[model samples]
Target: MGNQTEVTEFIILGLSNDPQLQIFLFLVFLLVYLITLLSNLVIMVVIRADPHLHTPMYFFLSHLSFVDICYASTVEPKMLVHFLAEHKTISVNSCIAQMFFILQLATTEIFILSAMAYDRYTAICDPLRYMERMSKEICVQLVSGAWAIGFFHALLNTVFALKLHFCGPSQINHFSCELPPLLQLSCTESLTNQVVLLTSAVIFASSSFLLTLISYIHIISTVLRIHSAEGRRKVFSTCSSHLIVVGLFYLTGFLQYTKPSSVSSVVLDEMFSIQYSILTPMLNPIIYSLKNKEVKTAVGKMFQKFKFLK
Candidate 1:
């Protein structure tokens, strides 16, 4: 990959072909994006205004909302625009930048999920010591660790992308600069890139998934040990949202990346990617917050306060 081979820009063949479908998809995705933004923003505002929501659980919840805001924002807006556009193409640098941010937030979401799991772990497995254990200092550390993990994932992935020499067909048959789509457009041999990326993804994904799984297992076990059905329900209620979220995130993501790179159906790939990326992120703030009585109560209180101030 010399200067001559270095790609200055990339072309993105966005979502679909039919103009009618483009308008329809655009409206649908636009609605999804706005709701995602609004929902996440409401979560943040509610969390900040309510002193009771300033605890460890709400602390993690707030961050999860923030992450979902960013995670969904990164792709959906562009995707909406791409739907209605004729020449659905993105510059090479822009594509790379998009890829970087998407991967970063995605990786961050993984670790953040792990941190949330740990919070549940402490809340259930070590109830008496929960507050003392998951203090402010620990919260900061967990958030920091999440960012660090995401950065490294993005950094390595970017390096691999940079190493890839794009010498031929410049059109990316997807809406954004996703890993598989980007790799497909590269002219040079990408054996090394594939190997490195696959290994990294497996290790990171496996470790994070296992950690979350173990945390859930411990939480469920503790719930079972509690004699009262209501006691078990109380504990389960706190963690059930997180379990649903993590399951959706990991499973859809795994479906996108774990497949052999040689599989080249752009439509199928883009469809799966959209599910994991846009739909999943948008779902988090809505699903996680709506399903929980605590968050609903917090939001209701915050809304009442807002009305009083008005």
Candidate 2:
């Protein structure tokens, strides 16, 4: 902490400057926020209520949905307010707090995804050990480790980001208080900031991506070697949706910040951020519930119970 200046607030450049577009954007985001909350709530409820869903996968699924809800809630409501009002300003403290939660939840999400992949790998590759290995204690340990890692990673990132000197204009180019957008406002020589940001990013983001990749590689190889086409098809469907989600998220995220920030286009930058922040949250629930027969069956059973109670 060199010279802690009195930078009190920052203005967020949300989705649009156009007045007409602002209202429209607000409505869309509001709808998205509501749906995200409801869907995640439903997921958590169903997982908690249903005995058939008391598996490690659904346990992780419930947590994953909860994390996405947390993730979207951290960023989207602020953006929605910016669209609704004139003041898009965030206090320095508010910005720092937002970044901390964002980092914690986002990193937690990565680990959860990787854990799910590992779950899939074991269920497929070592079916017999799936029950033995992913026991209640092991599940608790894995989830605990994910939360601990997220907390520490976010702690380091927030600490490092707080040290940066924001001598330039306090207007962040993006909606949220993310590291990339916040770094754009710093006036000092930001070499160390950049390095630290990149390293933290790789630690949380890349590690999960690499694990997903390796798990999928083994999955595909084993699937291909199966003698029956029906066997291959059946296994493929079980993992395909997750594969799609992991691929889309990691690719967009990697392209967005992994390269030189100076070289990336503002339009592309905004697009990638929006895609990752808004769209991906919506997609997570859909990807799991839509094509998954087990989820669909569970949903139907839930509906039937409600109707009978009425």
Candidate 3:
């Protein structure tokens, strides 16, 4: 902490500088955030109310819905406020807290998605032993482990970030206090922090990504062995939504974080950040629910129950 001047707060330069653009963004994002909340809530409710959705896939999906709500809530409220404020600022502690939650939830989501892939693999490849393999006890443990790993990962990032010193010029280029932007603002030697970030990213993000890929590989190979085109189509439909989600998540995440440090672009980074932070959560529920007829029917049934209750 040599020559470390305490930094009290930081300015958050949000998505847009233009007044018109800010207003436009505010409305768009407000609508998007509301939809995210509503859709995820519906997913949870539909899953819980329908015994047909009590399977491992829907169980995992309900948890995923919970995460999507939490993940979006972590970032969007502050971002929405900033769009309307003249000067957007966050205290150092708050920024670190935001980053921590973001990291925790995002990492948890990655694990959840991988777990979902495993569920799908078991369902597709070993339908005979699906129940024996993915029992209720195992599902609980898998989800619990994902949450635990996310918590520790977030704790690690927050702990290391607290060690950094911020002297002045405390303007963050993007809307959030993400690890990379925080590192850019630090006055201290962040070599160790960078190494830790990179290492954790590789261990957490890379491992989960690889697992998903391998699971998908097995799933595809099994699907290809089916002789009937209709049988293949039916099997593929069950997984298409998940595959789309994985592609979007990994694509945006990799674009944002996996780039070489040598290449830096604030605008591009901000765009990609928008994709992962805001867009993905908003899209996930819609994608999963609309694509899966089971979810749609469940939601419809739920609506009918509400009507009867009324």
Candidate 4:
């Protein structure tokens, strides 16, 4: 293929066209973005302040919250701007950067969730050795490893994406800069890019998902061995939030990215991406806070402290 480089920027045809709907979506997403930031910040602050939450589980949860905040920040702010901006255009470099960060943070989140599942498994299945197993040092390494892996994974994808040459029809039919939408705008042959995307998605997503699934299998097996219903309930409560989060994250991600490229619909891809990237971050902190008693107590204590300070 000969060089056909011409387009320098992309026009993002965002979620809606009507003025009323644009304003409405802008407000709705603005509110959601703020709440996501506040909730995740609260989770992190409360976890750090409360001594009782200094365990490996809360440590992982705090990191998870941080990742959620980053994930939402990467996509939502740009989307909000697009909702109102007349140009709705982003430079190629800027678009690639957005996609890179989104992929990095999202990949980190999945790895972190897998770590959280392991933590739960250690807590419930081998309570006596939980501390011995998941020490502070180990927790730091795990979280760091997740971030590092995500970084490199994203780097690989971004490197491949960089090879794609965008020449014309630079209008992306999506709210944010994502791989699928961006690829559609590329004039260059995207065989290598698509192969890399599919390969990395399978490796990263499948491995983390399998780890989480295996951990949950052991967790369920351990929970069943307990004779008392209360004991089972307690154990289940500890993991139910994580399970729900995992399910939502994986389901939407799989539906969005794992489809055959020939059959992908831009509209459907955008909607599914919204579920995982936009809604999942907001839902995670709420789910954990609601389902976990310790988190609720920590939140209550933090609120009381704020009131006293006021």
Please report the TM-score between candidate 3 and the true structure.
0.97
Q: If candidate 1 were superposed on the true structure by all CA atoms, what would the RMSD be? A: 2.0
Ranked by lDDT, the better of candidates 1 and 4 is 4
Give the alpha-carbon lDDT of every model. Answer: 0.82, 0.83, 0.91, 0.91
Q: Which rank order by TM-score, best down to worst?
A: 4, 3, 2, 1
TM-score of each: 0.94, 0.95, 0.97, 0.97
Can you write out model 2's per-residue Cα lDDT over 39-97, one digit (the tens) per residue?
Answer: 87887888888899999989989988988888899989889889977888998889989
Model 3: per-residue lDDT, tens digit, 177-285?
A: 8889999999889988888888887789998999999999999999999999999999999999999998888887765666767786888888888888889998999
Give the better candidate number (1 or 2) by TM-score.
2
Residue 265, model 1, lDDT:
80
Candidate 3 local lDDT, residue 17: 85
Compared to the true structure, candidate 4 yields what TM-score? 0.97
> Cα deviation in Å at residue 111, candidate 4?
0.3
lDDT, candidate 4, 58-150, per-residue tens: 999999999999999999998999889888999999999999998899899999999999999898888899988999899999999999989
Clash number by candidate, in order? 4, 0, 0, 0
In model 1, which regions exceed 4 Å deviation? 1-7, 262-264
